[model samples]
Target: MRASDPAIRSALDHVILIKAHLLQLRESLTALEDVRHSPRGVVLIRRCMLDVRMVFEELMLLSVSAHGEAGDRVEQSLRKKHRADLKIRGLNELNPNFFPDAIDLVASDEPGVAGRFTSVCEPYLTVEQAKRIYFRSDQLLHASRIFMSTEDFEAHRGELIEFYGLTERLLRTFEIDISGTGFMVLGHLNLDDDAMPQVFEAQTS
Candidate 1:
């Protein structure tokens, strides 16, 4: 699809919002280190899980928004259901091509290079990975432990960190193949500077 197409623009807007939530998730994960044994640690951990949930929710919404009228029916059905697994499955059935198979990071050969660039593709986030993370996050979010102990927090620390890493890779640079003829790439030019999200376009077979 063309960059100016309403569907593409709407998808870009979703990317921007998802990026903001990802930044917040990163902050929460980083803050967990100093207070992992305290009450504040539990709060941060929960916040991280919440952020993940929100990210997946937005992703589903983005998919629905891109499909027009058919998408509206799916959205309504989604409203009636509250299960993450089912929601993911529903979205997949609606459009299996909604999620990209891998992320593409493009770099210039030299400082002044204009047209000379190379892209490295990494298969980090896939539908299965997303489902795993989403399910785990939901479980942790609704766990029975009201005030989790230090050992309990430690037990889940590695999993949470892994989830964060996977999520970061997914958002840092990825493309969504909307159809057979075109795809959209979304990423940041300079993450350190908090630059605005940028979207690029390319044609495919």
Candidate 2:
């Protein structure tokens, strides 16, 4: 929280902005108990899903800014493990430092290495899942013919919410326990269905 770099401050601000949008999306979802999707709600949710998926990429960019080579190593690991063309294209759009060769960034035990960062990320989102979400979000962004049924919308809503919370915890607290079950710590941090919707309303109003 006390970092001197302007980039760190920017990263924090971006995270807060992303969180706000995600919260607002949830607020929209709350009004749809009987039906799964409204036209407005669908648009908002898709936008938020795109943003939620970008949360990690943004963080990785920040990590690259802070740690340079170490961060590059992690990004490269993610890229190599991630085979999808859509995701590769997305990665290409990010900072060049986030691309490079030759390091096991995910499993390395060395202190201050990118592996620590990747380790924190692997459980919540593997490269494969990231690619899937990235492509789906892109499709939704383009107003492509992709359609989400009521059930699909609900499932995506839940998954995006969890992803947002876990990414938040990793970015804000620098905590990661791959050994532990799911993001329980994140669930405790105001991400619950009951907890966040109320707080989000209060903050927005």
Candidate 3:
């Protein structure tokens, strides 16, 4: 069987569902982008952040299901009876730190290996950014904290943009054929640069 074989039906389903969810999320982000000039933009920004957090959660689920030893557990958790259990498992399994493990898996002594892997895997958002977004999204979603200054709003808005970019990249990079859009290079296939996200260095003072 080829690496592109459909033998892993559950993973395929998960990818499709995640893509669909991402389409919903893109709509939300586009709405936020349009109304960003208004004062009400803050609220929309918050909603986008929440959606980003959700997308991140689903990405983690896909990561574990696709790459972890507990892949079978991930499959079980997808069923109706196991959803609650899956929530707990997701918390532990989807930790963004899993990126390092993924890096390790792709580690090689080849000169360009590190650069290529970092470009593809860690791409835009850092692990720290992921955690911060998840945390802040939680605070905003539950109304556990309420302080929205202009600076804070700008910061969150920037983060939301970055989050949006990262999510889009992940979907495109690891996407499967069932979704009708994806960038995974089949055996002997070349990666299409236009299909990949444009890389930009984050400015830091």
Cand. 1 Cα-lDDT? 0.65
Per-candidate local distance difference test: 0.65, 0.45, 0.49
Per-residue CA lDDT of model 2 for 1-205, tens digit only, reads 4343443443344345545655664664565444457676577677676565555454344433443454465467555654336446544444332321111123546777443222233334344555566666655666657666777777777767665554444333232111112111111123334432110100000
The sequence of per-residue lDDT tens digits that candidate 3 reaches over residues 1-205 is: 5543442443444545555555565676677666754557767766676566666555455444434445555445544432333444454553333331111124568876562233354665555666667667656665535457777767777777777676555444332222112212211101223232221111111
Tens-digit per-residue lDDT, 42-87, candidate 1: 7777788788777777777666555567467556756876777777
lDDT of 2 at 195: 37
Instruction: Indicate whether candidate 1 or candidate 2 has the larger lDDT.
Output: 1
lDDT of 3 at 150: 72
- How many Å off is the CA of 148 in candidate 3? 2.6
Off by over 4 Å in 3: 1-7, 37-39, 66-122, 144-147, 175-205
Residue 121 accuracy (lDDT) in model 1: 58
Per-candidate Cα RMSD to the true structure, in Å, reads 3.8, 12.2, 9.7
